[model samples]
Target: MEPVLLALKFLVPLAYLATTAIYGRLFFAPEESRFARKATLGLAISLILHIALLLCLGYSLQRCPLGTIGEGLLFLAWILAVIHLLSEWLADTRRLGLFTLLPTTLCVVVGVFLLRPDFALPPQLQSSFLVFHIVASLASYACFSMASILAGLYLVLHAKLKHKNFDITFRKLPPLDKLDKLSANWSFLGSATMVVASVIGWVWVRKDGLAGMNFKELAIYLVLAVFLGAGISRRLFGWRGRRHAIAILIGFLLMLLTNMIGTHGFQN
Candidate 1:
């Protein structure tokens, strides 16, 4: 098991790195989409290896692999990878791979460096409820991260069109409307997932007789508030395009800050 885990730790990141390279090639020279199928296969295999690695790590620790900040990074990479693959298939767009997979690959590589497979969970955090909360929270974070990437692309493409600079990159990008729609869809999903995760966390706290949330936990609520506010502005004020995209970007930053704080607390 140790040998398998060690091999997987190295292989998982390498697979993601290789797949990201393939996607980078496809992004620049989309005419070479003959390689897209092969890239997708590689990404699928990477995702499988990622899951297996998580399982092995969890089994080795005798707890959920989600007990530390580094483990959260691993989980987030897997969630984002899954989201990217599904979005590509559903939206039928392959050009966004470079933007998405670069960060996903980074997460896996950084996670490998930081992962402590021997870390033990405190008895207080050993509940089934905590597992669900962590899963949903990570899912929400991934969705927000994806939405931010799409929003950034939308702004870039919008600028290129405004300046009348229709380069090969512009031609390769998904249409403005598609980017807008995908960003909105991901933001909505992130908001919904955050709501569910928050409710579960609240219930768990109450069940455990905790009086209130800590500063790190409140940071999560800040994230939820940002997304909720963005959603409300969109529905009520008909916000879209640059305005909504900017809002999503802000939420993404907040999510990152929140994760860092949480991770710091865990390490302490």
Candidate 2:
């Protein structure tokens, strides 16, 4: 059973990748069609496979999978996939599936590279706070990163419109106004979630009697500062354009660094 589940862990990602590619082509080919529908279905299948893998892991050895870097990545990927689908279900989301599912595919590929071809839960990584923290924070990061990239692309297009340069990619993207609103909304949600995740992790650490400020903690603080500061600038001073995009990208990268430090320094 574990073997079969492990095989599924491999097969599921491959299927999602194929779906993403096929649907991406159909999406951008002649006319914008039901790419979202196809990606959503693919994402749904991947979630089920992740659940099956979790069940197999629990059956063999009850573990939380929080202690390993490899498990952490795929778990984060699954969480982001869920967030992506839910966000679409709740609101108007278009053409972001490519970004979301591509990263997910890359994450699973990393998992495959680190695969041991078996399931055994880690003994030292059992914390509900950590689980929720990773899930919420990574999902937040996923959405923010997706939105930030789109914003940057929009800025590129805007620049082209100003008689600077013209390109094919910029010609096909959504309108600048649409990108602006979506980026603002996504950033707002992600910033809130990240703040919550950071607070939760701090509470858990303090409760566990391990209240030392680590690199990851510092990184989180810095990211929060940048994101919130940019938000303030956007509101108060009417800051926009490249500054907004840069701040978003900077915060996104710092969030990635924070996760890396968290996984490497504490878990590893």
Candidate 3:
């Protein structure tokens, strides 16, 4: 079991790197080129392997493998890959793969190398509500990450359009309007999921009689507040285009900081 787990730990990242390479080639090649098909196939295979790895880890540990930060990172990467693939298929855009896979690859690398392996499940996490809360939170994070990538791309393309700089890359990217809409959709989904997760977390806290807010809890609430403000600003102030995109980027950064503080701040 240990040998198989080790092998999967190595194979998963290699598969992602290969997918990244394929997508990189697709970025340079035409949209209808064979590389696009290969990139999709590569991503499918990588996602399958990643899911299998998670399943095997859960089987070996005799519980959900998301008990540790390392395992959570692995799950986070898996969710990101799944979301990216679905968005690409729905939008029929291959160019975004380059932007999306970069961060997924980074997550896998960090999970495998930087995080310590821990399989011991905490007592509080054994509950179904708690498990779903964490899953929803992580899934929401994945959506926000994707939205951030789309927002970043939107800013780049918007700037290119403003400067009348029409390069091959610019031509390959989705239209600014499409990018903006996609980013907004992702942000909406993320915020909705976060709200549901927050409700579940509150219920769990009340049931368990946990103490006052911890650093992680405070950070999460702050992220939720940011999302709420962004939503309100967009609807009431008519903040669209670059303004909306910048809001998404800021929200994603805050989410990242929340994750960092959650993972490291409470360790001591």
Candidate 4:
């Protein structure tokens, strides 16, 4: 059942990528403006399909789709897609979607392909808190990744502007200040989520099965601390621009590493 679900997950992402790629090209094309509208419709269709597939998986498994590396990452990708779409509407930017959503879909597909299908849930993961923790952490990671991209864009823009040359791509971006504010806000929100999740996780660990200091526990703490500390600095000293972007990238990388090490090594 797990393997079949794992295989089925691939279809949704493939559908997603196909649609988004079409959107990206259509959005950039000069010949026709209809492409953007068409592409957006495609994205909408793909999203609905993805959500339905996930619901089916959850219903069949009678679990919160957190059972394995593949399921978790794919769901994370779904979340990122949702967030990306919402942010696009809120921020009023179509160009950014091409960068953030496409890679996420690809990565989710790859994660689903590589991860084990029958990965059993441990005794400790039986609680609702575990779901909260996992969901919060992944959502935060997605935002931070977005922030990092914003930062990278800032770098490229700043460089071109510094050289006294106008780059078309840079001009399309929201004002420098707007992008900076968005990145900071994303990280700040992500950090808050992580902190809340971590606190709940502590309670879950205390009550369920985890009492000793496990490597995974330590990793979670380290990630929580990194984001919290960064958030504090941003709030106090007005952290923004390149420095903020670098910090977001660094923090997300730590979170990813901890996830990889814990899920793979500990499972054996």
Candidate 5:
């Protein structure tokens, strides 16, 4: 098992790289429809290997794999890969693969290389409910990242159109409406997942009779508020077009800030 885990530590990143390359080729050469199937196969294979690697690492450590920043990043990479693959299967569009998988590959490479398994898992963090809460939070973050990426692309394409710059890059991107819809879908998913995470945290707090909130908890709640606002504005006020897209981008930024504060705290 040790040897297998060691091998997987390296194989997972390579698999992500190979999968990303497949997506790149598919995106640049849309004429060759053959690459579509190949891309999907590569993504699926990479995702499977990534999952196996994480599971093995967790088993060996006798703890969740998210004990450190690197491990948390690996988990995010896994979730991003999972979401992108599901999007491809459900939407039947490979247009977003290159954009999505490039960051995923980078995350895997950084995470795999930066892994610090020697770090001890805190005893207080071993509760199953806490693990679920953290998992849910990470899942929400991954979805928010996806939503932001989509929104950024939409903005870029929108700018190109406004400037009358119709290049191959513009043509390669999904249509504005498609990008808008995809971004909205991912944002909604992120919001819903964040709600779940918040609920889990609340339940854990009540179950343990915790008295006070930590900085990380405050940040999470603030991030949740941002997403909830975005959802409400879109639903009730009929906010659409660039306004909604920009709102999503802003929410993503807030999420990132929350992560940073959670990681570093405000002791200074």
Candidate 6:
């Protein structure tokens, strides 16, 4: 089972890479082309395989698969891919594939090749509440990641429009307004999830008598606050387009910074 799990871990990323190639064809193909359908189908299959791999890992370890940094990275990549597929289904947009899949593939590559998997599940994460909190937080991070990618695309389109560079790529991207709304929607979802995760984390910490107001916790809250502020500004001040995009980009940077400082269970 261990050997099978390891092989699946390697295979999952290759599947994702194949999906990326199929999606890349969408750049030249029509919106409703056969390639778009194939790409969507490929993503669905890849997601299923990824989930199965995680389940096998969990079963083999007799614990949650998210006990190690490498496992967490794989889980995060899975969440991103799932969320992207959901978004694609809801919006019927294939263009977001490249942006989303690029990071997804990178995450899988890093998880499989760069990070070492620790089979030991820490005592601190034995609680179900902590597990839920961590899962929710990772999901929120995935949402924020999608928002940042959309925001980046928004800025690129905005620049092209500003300079009147009506090239093929410019025409290929989603409309500025659509991208803005999508970014905002993802940000709102991420913020809401972050709030829930934070509350759960606080409660768990208090119940366990652990110090909850650490630097990493503070950083996570700060990032959540930025997302909330961005959403509020969008609603109250009617901030959109470039400014809103920049705010989301900044929030994503803060998220990366928080990850760099330390994640939940791994923090000092």
Best by TM-score: 1
Better of 2 and 3 by TM-score: 3
Better of 1 and 2 by TM-score: 1
Model 4 ranges off by over 4 Å: 1-10, 26-32, 115-117, 264-268
* Ten residues in sequence with the least summed lDDT for candidate 5: 259-268
Candidate lDDT values, in order? 0.87, 0.69, 0.83, 0.70, 0.83, 0.85
Per-residue alpha-carbon lDDT of model 4 for 115-143, expressed as tens digits?
55346677556668768878877777777
TM-score of 3: 0.93
lDDT of 1 by residue, 46-136 (tens): 9999999999998888888887777888999999999999998999767788899999999899998999866777766878987899999
Q: Write the per-residue lDDT of candidate 3 for residues 1-268, one digit (tens) a residue.
A: 7788788889999999999988888887765487878899999999988988888888788777777777778889999999988988898767789788988988887787743445565565667775787799888998889888999999999999999998977888899999988988888889899998888878877777655468787888788777667778888998988999998998889898887764422121
lDDT of 5 by residue, 180-238 (tens): 88888888888888899889877876776554578777877777777677778878998
Per-residue C-alpha lDDT of model 6 across residues 183-258, encoded as one tens digit per residue: 9999999999999998898888877766547788888889998989999998999998899999999999999989
Segments of candidate 2 deviating more than 4 angstroms: 34-37, 115-124, 163-168, 261-268
Off by over 4 Å in 3: 30-32, 114-118, 263-268
Q: Report the error of model 6 at residue 54, Å.
A: 0.5
Runs of candidate 1 exceeding 4 Å displacement: 263-268
Q: Which 10 consecutive positions of candidate 2 have the poorest summed lDDT?
A: 116-125
For candidate 2, write residues 128-241 as lDDT tens digits: 676778766776777677667657766777788887555654555667777676677778877888888878877777666553676667787898788788788989998776
C-alpha lDDT of residue 105 in model 6: 88
**Pairs with steric clashes in candidate 3:** none
What order do candidates take by TM-score, descending? 1, 6, 3, 5, 4, 2
Q: Give TM-scores for every candidate, taking all chains together and pairing residue i with residue i.
A: 0.95, 0.83, 0.93, 0.85, 0.91, 0.94
Model 5 segments more than 4 A misplaced: 209-211, 264-268
* Model 3 worst lDDT window (10 residues): 259-268
